[model samples]
Every structure is written in C-alpha cells, then in structure tokens.
Target: MEHSIFVMCILAVLSIALANPIFQDFSQLKAVENANKVLQLVDQEVLSNHKLGQQSSLPQKIDWREKGYVTNVKDQGQCASCWAFASAATMEGQLFNKTNNLITLSEQNLLDCAKSYNDKGCAGGWMSHAFKYIRDNGIEADGTYPYTATKQECSFNEANSVGTLQNYVKLTKTTEEEILKAVANHGPVGVYVYMSSLFMGYKSGIFEDDSCTETPNHAVTVVGYVNTPQDQYWIIKNSFSKSWGEDGYMRMKMNKNVCGITYRLYYPIV
Candidate 1:
C-alpha cells in the first residue's frame, strides 16, 4: 500500500520529467533512425495517458532484493566495463523472471568474448551490443568465469553456460514515464546516462546534476523508483561496490535526467 503510493508520486514526477530536451520528440533525436525502432512490449492503449488514468493508478515500486531475489552488489574495479556489469545484472533479472532462479552471470565472459561483437572489454562498450552477444552466444555463470575487473582471453565454455537470453527489446519511446512503466511491468533494465564528476563522490542524497551533459557515457541498471512528495528518484544499482552511494545504489531525482537516465532503455527477453 505504501509502495503503491510511493510509485504513484514518482511517476507523477517523471511525467513532468518527460519534457527534458533529452526526451524530446523523435525528429529532434540525433539517433532518430534508431529511435524509430521501438519494440511494442507494452500496449499503447493501456498507456494512452502518461500522467493520469487507470494505467497511472498502478505505480510500480519494485525492489527485487526485497522480494526474496538476491543480486549481489558487484564491483567493476578500475575498469571501464560498467556496460558489462549492467548487462549482466539485467540478464540475471530476466533469468529470474523466466524460471524463478536468480543466478549471477559473468561480466568477465562479456569483457573477453564479446570483442568480436564490437565490445572493447574494459575499454568500454554498449549495453545493446552486450545484449546482442548474450542472445547470440549464451553467457557463462559467474562461478564458472568470475570477474577479473580487466579484459582477458576468451575462455568461455558452453558447458558453463547459465541462463539463456532470447533477445533484447528497446523501448518504443524514450521518456521517464515510459521508463517507469517498463520497470513496473518488466524487471530491471539497462540504461545509458552521462556520469558527471559530481556523481563520482555521491554519498546519500537525491542526485540532480544541472551540469550534466546531454550525451550518455556510462551504463547502469535501474532497479526501482520511489517518491514521497518531496523525494522522487530512481534507484540505480551501479557496479561501484557496496562502499559507493547508498550501499552500491544511487538515488537519482526523477524530474531531472542528471545522468541522461532516459536516453537508452532496454531489457532482456529471456
């Protein structure tokens, strides 16, 4: 009951946030060609109204960890492989959704093997490409491959493969409201956001960086959202270890895309 109310308020905040230049109309998007490729995973009729209506009544306030699902806080450690960690986390969530088994997958497998798929290992990568790699060649279990926090030779064995990824879906529309809908209906999702220096030392607070750039430079998973009139934000599960932010999670304000949180939104189809 409390969670329902919390999400209702956050979605209210995000609805206003949809007007950010980053979430502008399709024609203005630099990636307009790609923006045209929106998958219809959610029914448009059910969500015709973004701010108010029956659809708006069901606010999603999800926290997989609070519901018996356990996803350990992983540390990428000195590596620019945040994309791998984000992808791994999304895949883990989708795996749990399909079979009710939440097994941690390997970020190292992607760091090494996905090079052929255009991933630069620790140098950097895109979550969309990482999802493609998982769809084509299944990922290895963390127990089998383990994270080295650095790029290494591809020693991925099919015998150690954990969950299967069917494909990945991009949001039909990029809006904070749409992001909320996805997280509420679907599980956790991978997002692209520009991380400013201000976020480097984020401790405890609702992050809203006015100096944040429009371009996205980092990848992370959005686990949930919450609001209490004054506090409305997205709970991001980063790969910066438990020592960072609120126990490895950062609360970014909803009405502002400080980190370009609504730029690239995608979830795995397990």
Candidate 2:
C-alpha cells in the first residue's frame, strides 16, 4: 500500500504539470498576421532618434531575482496591458536599487493617466510614452492606485506617488551586448518583443522560435541573463501570472535578436 501511494503522488504531480497550458504542443500553431497589432502603436521614429550611451562590461551571469530588485509576478488578465506592466516593473527595480525598498507600483496608473502621451490603456500602448508620463507626473504605488486590468478614467494623484523617474534612456538598437550591459549595470529593462503563438505556449527551455517576426507586439522586463557554453539566454519577466512559463518568466536565446528583443530596450533613471 505504501508503494502504491508513492506512485499515486507522482502521478498527481505529473497530472498538474500536464494541465498547464504552456505544456501544450504548439507545433501546429499558425502565425497570425494580426497577432501583434497592439505593438503597432509604438513610434519607431522617436526610438530611433533617441541617443544611446557607451556600453559597459557585463558579467557572464546576472540575476536580479537574487539581487532583490524584482517584484512578484503579476497577471494582466485579458487586458493588453503588457506595456504598462513592463514599465512599472522596470521602475520598481530602479526604485528598489535606489532606496533598497522594493515597492510594487501601479500599472493601472499608466493605463489610465498616460493616455495623454498617446497610450490607449488596455487596447495598446508604448513603454517609452509611459516613462515620459512617469517622469512628468510620477507614478503611484499599487496600494494607492492598484491594477484593475481594464481601461478606466484617469485618477492620478501625485501625492500618493511612490516612485518617480528622472529620465529614461533608450539602448542602441539591435545590439545585444549593449543591452546586456544595461541590464547588468542598471536593474531591469523594459523591452518589446514579437509575441508569436509558440511564445504563448512556451513552458521551459530556451525559447528560440524561428517563426517569430521582427515586429514587437508585447513588452516585458529583462531581469537578467545566463551564458552557457552551448546556449545563452535572457531572463525575461512577464506579467501573465505565475502559472505561465517558469512562473511568469521566460528565457529566450541571447545575441540572436530573437523576436526583436534587442530592437528597442529602455530603462528608467530614478
């Protein structure tokens, strides 16, 4: 009976793993033309014209999670608020590094208040624009404003703000080395990437979807990186809840410009 119970426990764990959507096979997942319409709102000209500084040297391995800058994974639900989440996460890291206090900021604040900067809230938005809003008006704490995962009227109150950005700097486009240096020296970075069907179903291992396009449609935070002799990858923190890839995180193949991860990366200066 004891042996049988052990087998049953193992089976239960396997059952739970199989039930996760990320485990589903995506071999037949077709690439959709409009799969990334939300990212089309980004003003490429502004990003391109932005000046970049010299690259700093980066360590072979760095993890912000171990350094205590990363916040808990968040769930955006059905909202296309990846841009807001990414912006807030990067700010949280910067704030923590500055004050040694890890406070969760409100993505809803950006969703509602940053529309003046051309953000469409849950419909779609740009991280660069969100940073501009934060720099100008400041961002409230999650406890003050909170995330509703839906479009709401602006209820911004600067008095309740927990963080503010002095400025934001864009990294050199298509330069993976520069991006690595930025993440290593700074805390986390806000970056855009193509959200392919395979990416949606990613569970584990280094994600290197060849079907991914250069068009970035979703924003996420790059918290760290790993360099193995065989494979190198970027540690990405997603806002899709802890149930997704490696507890709402993903590692994509590094230095290949996978899914335009290196195209437009920016970080806040607090």
Q: Write the per-residue lDDT of candidate 1 for residues 24-131, one digit (tens) a residue.
A: 221121121112122111113221222311254546356766753449899887677878888998888888877888898999999999888777776677676787
Position 257, candidate 2: lDDT: 86
Where is model 2 poorest over a 10-residue stretch in terms of lDDT? 27-36
* TM-score of every candidate: 0.77, 0.82
| Residue 145's lDDT in candidate 1 | 97
CA lDDT of each prediction against the hidden true structure: 0.71, 0.77
Which candidate has the top score in lDDT? 2
Q: What's the lDDT for candidate 1?
A: 0.71
User: TM-score winner among the candidates?
Assistant: 2
